[model samples]
Target: MPVSPTYRPEPRFFDLGGEYGDPVRAADFPETRLRFRNDRAAATVGLETLTDAEWIAHFGRFVPLPGQPGPVAMRYHGHQFRHYNPDLGDGRGFLAGQLRDDEGRLLDLGTKGSGTTPWSRTADGRLTLKGGVREVLAAEMLEAQGVPTSRAFSLIETGEALQRGDEPSPTRSAVLVRLSHSHIRFGTFQRAAYFGRPDMVEALVEHSRSLYHPDLAEGDVPGFMRAVVEASARLTARWVAAGFVHGVLNTDNLNVTGESFDYGPWRFLPYYEPGFTAAYFDQTGLYAFARQPEAVFWALTQLGGALKLIADAEALTEALNGFGPAYIRELRAAFLSRLGVKSLGEAADQRLLDTTLALLREGGEAMRWEPLFHDWFGGFASSARALSGPRATLYQSKVFADFRFSLFDHEPDRPERLEAAPFARPEPEEMVIDEVETIWAAIDGGDDWTPFHEKIARLRAMGAARNPTESP
Candidate 1:
């Protein structure tokens, strides 16, 4: 296969030696059918020019890219739902390859449902087609909302029927390739700490910093922790602003780079319910809609404990302590950005944020989450457009008075965005549970992918409209 000049392979994970991971091979499926391909994401690494045959040969057949190492199942331990699980790692997938993008940032091409590894335990390492479809949708939706998340690079339907307890049995199976900034999770350090291997912990810290946070001084564990804290805080705030609930926020799922990935049972809020839980099994609402910030902070504390194996405890504690204030700052900025308004000041921004949440809380199910931001995107400048639209009565209610008054004091940032095609619609593009199920039903019942492809196209258009400066 011909290689693009821009494709720069960098198999850096191999540098970590045998202790960090084990060589793995993909399962040979009976058939390979390409389901989805993210050309936009592929363009980042210059893999967009390949023919469909070549694409399948490389991604589907698991052929190693030029100058890239073979797949390796990474080793790590994590806490699952607050329970420390020593037997946790890459059970179903592996780090397929690594490459540098146009911006010179390192990116990992990781897989899900590729095959089994030492971490597989007794469960079959296969991903249901519906699960793969859900992940693609979740990633795209989150990206459109400006959340830091992995890109669903490729999805291939492997001809197989897998048994799953979560949904109907004998469902279709698939393999998914995700493009992400890093796969080094918080659990990576926990694994090293669990084995009482301080040297391994130190080496892992140095490896991560050298690749991901090169700006930090060497041996500056505190600096690294601070950076991770801020990134995690920003991600959590963005999730809240986007009305997304990451159902399972286990330590293994939370990467050190703070990019959200490993989507399962995730959801976008239909309303502003604080206690909304995405996972049906989450009866206690541990990772609820409003408590995401707290959940993330708790994860950071675990990371801090692991880092203490090589760093000063006091410095680590100080870095961990920054999560609360950092979350508050990021939350204010995220909400303001979503509302499409320029900040007046710290005090005024906080006031507007408080009133905005209060209005959502008061309006409850009457005010859907996405429309509030979509209708009032440009703050006061969008008032006439908003008031004339579908939910005018809701906006006119006394409960929304304070939020309405708050918008008056701020100027619209890029008010021209209101003229975009997405804003012309009565409702914003939403990826609620029902819509997701409908799309899957179309596929499951008749293998009709029309709805799936249409949703992606609409979502890309919506993303382009909202983020004018970003590539769709």
Candidate 2:
């Protein structure tokens, strides 16, 4: 059952000054417009249960509720683009509140470009509809790929004018409220360290331990550091396997919850290229697809530096060192899943994937990322002499020929029994982004919805396919 737009949500509040500084109401902006409402995501984060009246009660305005304290800018410094910046925080954003899900996870509900706070500096502190839309698209696609991400809840077009680096003019305005596990970042600790505020640093660590590391009863600060290290290792491994380039994996962007946040200059590679990068400014390829693991390690070191203030230096170093084996294990799991192969010995798995990547790299300009994976999962049919035409050319290359023999004892005709097996599972109807786009397009054109309704029903039937459960 899909969540709908009309569900009512419960209300909760948090003092925003701890991190988020302040907020400006959308109604005050001239170009404000209501652009999109992501009801599906709202439902997932437990906000979709909000009734119409309740929605009005909570977010209709930016006023503080009874006992709700005033917001303040969270003070923190960070390393941006590998250079240390001793000042960075919720410059253009503020936390509206916080909510606990049915699973008892505390999530920060915050807004971007909501308005100016003490940290706003010289900027207008506003967001454009374009930025909001891109975030929606990116978050939805990433969620489907099993990445832990900050979920976008409401995007309201402020109809006010705004300027940005990506757009031509200060034409449209918008505000994006997001739900995230926690906004405490690596920079939070960096700020305390820079100020020589060990007490504040310790206090922040304790707060974080209470929030994200509730199970840290074993080794105090050392255990908490280890948990964060392991979570980051696993998170980064998934980022690499998903072909995601975060572009700017700065210390400020590294959330304590180990979820990916701050979607900027991110791109999913069309094919596997270690040098591929999303941020145009990253000419040095510091945060390229292949370098993410190392970048994560560097960030973890910064984390270790902060933990050192609270715990023993040697213990923190030992915990941070766990990233290597943890990363390899995760990478192997992801690779095996993509290859549609049952458990393979570590050596065999590495050889198989490494050989395949080598084959793709040899293709250079002609390579397509998914096809290599798709083709190999299709039984490397050319090796069996069962593939024909364009696909046969894939095998003709001298680069791939050497590995073909390694995959098969002797190239035989397609395995008769396996050849007829079904390929991918039929996609879900309501869940397909393409179908949803068509429906929205029709609505935008102001067309009669009766015909569209019938079309959707037929398409839904075509999209449904039942099969035995299997992991891939």
Candidate 3:
């Protein structure tokens, strides 16, 4: 592996001190087997130069990166499934450190399954290998869909066995590292307000604004609210357009940065069914596919309330109110983008979008999600050969007349990608539960990582077709 000539580490979160987090060391595991390495991400932090041994030493052994003293176990509280839980915090993970990327943005390398901390409580702070593998797949698939997401930076197998009710007992264990814009969550702000500490809320907000939304003026909490609200709205819309159901939208699970992370029980809809629920425990379908937009808005509202402690009440309220329209607008654009069409105008675009949705519904229960867009991906320009199975009939029906007519007026976005050889295949890569479980079974049976690695490679190709350019 190639390495960077110089190492650039920026350790700043510790500056906030004891009020925000506690200094903690990672658990000493008996062995470290590097299963995955994100060289693309590693290069950004000037860590590409690391020898495998050094990589294990710093990331695996939990030795602090050279310039940093130690990892800080962050403290924050939030509402879990609508109930405020003050005891919640980072029990098994910690913010390893921050580093400046090529674009000059500070990125955090957060760890999961590192060890137990004060917040670990009665549980052992270890992550199941299955859990770690699922997160990698989820993040990769989401990024392939052009959603703003944290990168699965690394996965290191720990020489330990763990028992869990979710899977067979004595399952393998691993640690996951995620490279993300900010670990500052909606709960991070909620923790301050939970204790009736307005001053602390103000401090956290200021520190966060400077790190990510520095364009906003100091103490401009209103400006910051609008930015986060807008980002979150767009993020939610993208999730909807991508047919992604984030099983848990709890306040603590949702990041204030609006970048999706901490994947658990996430599922991509195989069809356009709104009733699709990912997590089996979600009895009421609280976070079902169709209800996702509403769930995110609720989370954003909670975040707004937390920010209200420092930002102006009127401004915060207004900003919170903007989520609805922002969501609709972003949804339209994201959906259109996914369909590989350029928007003609707001009215025409909305008409095409509305008609498309109607077709998906009226097309019968057999309508699969991806094929709708994948079939008519570049709008009316695509041949009928592009579609197969049940959806193939819907386009021939009267319901699709308006959709077809409206699509012709708009130019297809980067339609050249469709001509790529992959389109010649019967289907694009999909991340349904069955496929995810199959991949996990291979790993569990014989430590076979080929399926996982190949899936990522295929996903990267799909991403190139969606957005040829890389995002920061």
Query: Candidate 3 regions off by >4 Å?
Result: 1-7, 384-391, 470-472
Error of 2 at 122 (Å): 0.9
Better of 1 and 2 by lDDT: 1
Candidate 3 lDDT for residue 267? 95
- TM-score of each model, in listed order: 0.99, 0.77, 0.95
Q: Comparing candidate 2 with candidate 3, which one achieves the higher lDDT?
A: 3
Give the 10-residue window scoring lowest on summed lDDT in candidate 2.
Answer: 463-472
Candidate 1 per-residue C-alpha lDDT over 114-191 given as tens digits, one digit per residue, 9 for 90 to 100? 988999999688899999999999999998888999999999999999998898989999999999999999999999
Best by lDDT: 1
The true-versus-predicted C-alpha distance at residue 212 of model 3, in Å, is 0.8
**What global local distance difference test value does model 1 have?**
0.92
Which should have the higher TM-score, number 1 or number 2?
1
Least accurate 10 contiguous residues by lDDT in model 1:
463-472
Better of 2 and 3 by TM-score: 3
Clashing pairs in 1: none
**Cα lDDT of model 2 by residue, 286-378, tens digit:** 999999999989998997897677689999999999989888887765655444444446776666566667777787646555445445542
